[model samples]
Target: MESSSNSKAKPRSEVLKIMEGLAQELYAQIERGEEPVLEIPSRTLSNTVWDPKRRIVVLGPDKLKRRLLDMKESKRFMQTILMLKLIVSSIREGVYPTIRDLYYNGKHTITFRVPNVGAVRENTWDEQAESNAAIEDLEVGLNVLREEMGLSADVKGKVVGPIVVRSKGFEIDATRMGDTALGLPPNPDELDIVKIEASYVLVVEKDAIFQRLNREGYWNRENAILITARGMPDRATRKFVRRLNEDYKLPVYVLTDSDPYGYYIYSVYKSGSIKLSYESERLATPDAKFIGVTTSDIINYKISSDYVIAANERDIKRAEELVRYPWFQSEAWQKEINLFLKMKKKVEIEALSTHGLKFLHDYLLEKIHSGKWIE
Candidate 1:
């Protein structure tokens, strides 16, 4: 049975001790490139960079003394001993651990004596080994995920600060004084944003397109600088886009593909998560507009044989439903939907030739800069 005093029972002081160990373990896990669990009372205590004083107060000194005393001198029956754990992370302002080599790579294989209730000596090793095994598995999984995602660049380089209490769930962090994420895009109308006379900004989903534009020198040098969503658009991306208007006073043009997946991506960027709609709606990038690969484009531009890739039944159903959705019910969307029902095809941005896309690039640049594209 779960404790009735779950929320209230968690003292602030106990929250600190649980988090300090959690911070150590989480640091170990991330060093191995794993997703560390950030549960409370840790999130409550050490979420935003570690302050040994204020945050750690989640567990009071008295509460920790009681818990520690219960573990130490109580050879007697003190039946209830639940341990709270945390994984505290400090971005740049953390003391780097002096990693001691494991016995059999002991730094990786953590073996410690955890004193729990109803044990012969002080505790049990059976559950200890199992829990330690879980950490090992998590570490290995993180390593594999990094390699698979080609995120070695990020995993090795990305710095985390301290986790703080936001109204929503988790953010990067702020435990120490000076450990902020440098890559964080500025708030709208903040500094470092350059104003462009061009009206439109092209936001792409992949790095390849942005890299290609720079390498090929295809984009309007002064009109549009490319922005990559880095896969999915997040708070960071939305912040950046919101700024193009409020900061740089530029209109936006989003260009992706005519695929069902790309349609969903544009929808999410415009209106936020479809499933988590209520919670995520506010996070949506309200400043951008969609501009390519409509259903009509798929049919008019699509080659039936090559464009008709085997879309899953789910995707087909989603495409149909998307057409009916109020947001995409405009004439441009309706025409696209009708064509989709007929050909059931998709069009990729790649399908647009260098010459063809260059024309679009020029058209979009002209429209944006001329103030004709602003809604």
Candidate 2:
């Protein structure tokens, strides 16, 4: 299967070549009697930088070297090499392995006698996190996505719209999915967007709302694409949204609850989180706007006090952090966040049901047509 139309993942042949090159470099180091070292861009928080120009978080120029000769780094260096071997094998054998599968495939115990001590045991990797970290190192070092390397992961995104996508030589039209939405593939980058006839894309935070809108023919009525990742979006969903915004120039609107968590989710879709800044260029849609169930909505839409939930300490803390983010510094966002803080209250998207089940349709229409959204 090929990568998505706009994905930066290298072709399979190129991915294989890159992996081969990496292995050859290590082999050459061994032949030359030099300590083999792998230089990877650091994924630390300190290395994550905000690119004002791009309006996205990105990795700064910081590198970490894992040297085989160093006692502290030796284990990680070996793990990286092991992961590279497993990934290369998978690519050549035409087998797709999930991250969990890779972890189990590489997990093993080693027992050896110490010079003056009894036998000691060590595991290749005790947890999936270690193997996942190794995979990420390979991804960043090789400049190729894991999806390009034939790795798979759980996909949570679903879509329904006036669009057509091709996966593995099979065409799937989003508009004709009946009562069900098209489930996004594990690697959305591999799905080729065949055709798009939508004016805009509406991204919902809740799956139930997406289903509600789809079943109610929201996309049909508005001539738009609708998508949801259930909650905080996965990488495939984020990348797909980015493609729609960047490749198709579709105006993307995010609808979420009025809480800090919801605001953070929208931020992830727009500017991306600092933890995964390296993937921001491909996954983040900087132009995406928030069509929220904002704190103001509680007052503006006459949402009953019974439906408004009081914010907890966690919500307060998250709101404070959001206020300081570079992207959230806009006057509109500041007002919304500050309002939420002052009100010490939050409301769910379903709170709109207080008016009527069909009120959500009108709310969405007003948000889009009246240009009532925060970027």
Candidate 3:
């Protein structure tokens, strides 16, 4: 065996962290209208890792065990350059942005990058789950720094909002902007009660839901903004929620399904999602909540006629246990949970449309005339 200790290649983690920080400095230097003194190191394509698919060296210097050890710490970091190459290459070749967002199901994963500022923030980031930490933190940090050079997460944060694809075969989102529409007195930051207008809002989870309501003429009549997250809630959704809280003076009422996926959806909305753009975390983390999918709705609808989703044992157990959780004990959540338990079947807002034109008119009328519908 040869002595592979004299390798100069930085560990994937170290290299990524180093390059990312440099990239940001280079980026910031440019932003400050100064010439960027960037010296992107010339890392030899030493095959430290293997790649059967590309039939090429995923890592350099196949004999360099030292670099291999660095890779062991973070597989995604080592793959950053490769990931960037693939992404930029794809972009240059005109892959659709939405398609790019969904690109990591095969050889990689899509992740978002966020950076942690100051020294102590490292510990704060480390506390997050490992997989989440990698894709959402360090990897995200590196990617976002590069992305931030062009765009922003929000006007205030100056953080880069990018969907990253990790070489470790994954994806992440790194952004930190809240909806400006959900709060009172017309502004969330200012918290002005005077700007408060409506008492509640109904947030649907899908565009199909919104479109159905609109087609049925519920949108204009209901007088409540019927917006869809179009799947997972994005920055736009957060801002909308915030605006509801700040500007609209409306109690934002989420209307999602009774499934685990829906529960996670609600969680992401209220709390901030994880940031995955750093090696050891050089960024921020956000958390959100899911206030809808009340078990009570499942119970109230009388699951006798057209109600039947075989609840997995896990689903049954979770829905039962969720009711006991303190947060769900709020008057509304409690009521919703009870409804779900009683029926033993969930009522997706989408289902209401099956009742056709009558359901839309009734649901919206109920919403507008009664504050309870939203609250």
Identify the leading candidate in terms of TM-score. Answer: 2
Can you tell me which runs of candidate 3 are displaced by over 4 Å? 1-21, 24-135, 138-201, 230-251, 258-264, 272-314, 317-331, 338-343, 350-356, 367-369, 373-375
Candidate ordering by lDDT (highest first): 2, 1, 3
Pick out the ten consecutive residues of candidate 3 with the lowest summed lDDT.
276-285
lDDT of 3 by residue, 150-173 (tens): 111222111112111122233222
lDDT of 2 by residue, 1-375 (tens): 223356544668889999999999999999999989999999999999999889999899999999998999999999999999999999899899999999999999999899889899999999999999999999899888887887888788999999998888999999999998899886776777888889999999999999999999999999999999999998889988998888788999999998999999999999888778888877899999999988899989999899999999999999999999989989999999999999999999999998998999999999999999988
Runs in model 2 lying further than 4 Å from the true structure: 1-5, 112-120
Taking all chains together, the TM-score of candidate 1 against the true structure is 0.47
For every model in order, what is the number of clashing pairs?
Answer: 33, 1, 92
lDDT of model 1 at position 13: 36
TM-score of each: 0.47, 0.94, 0.44
| Cα lDDT, all candidates | 0.42, 0.91, 0.40
Task: Rank candidates, TM-score, best first.
Answer: 2, 1, 3
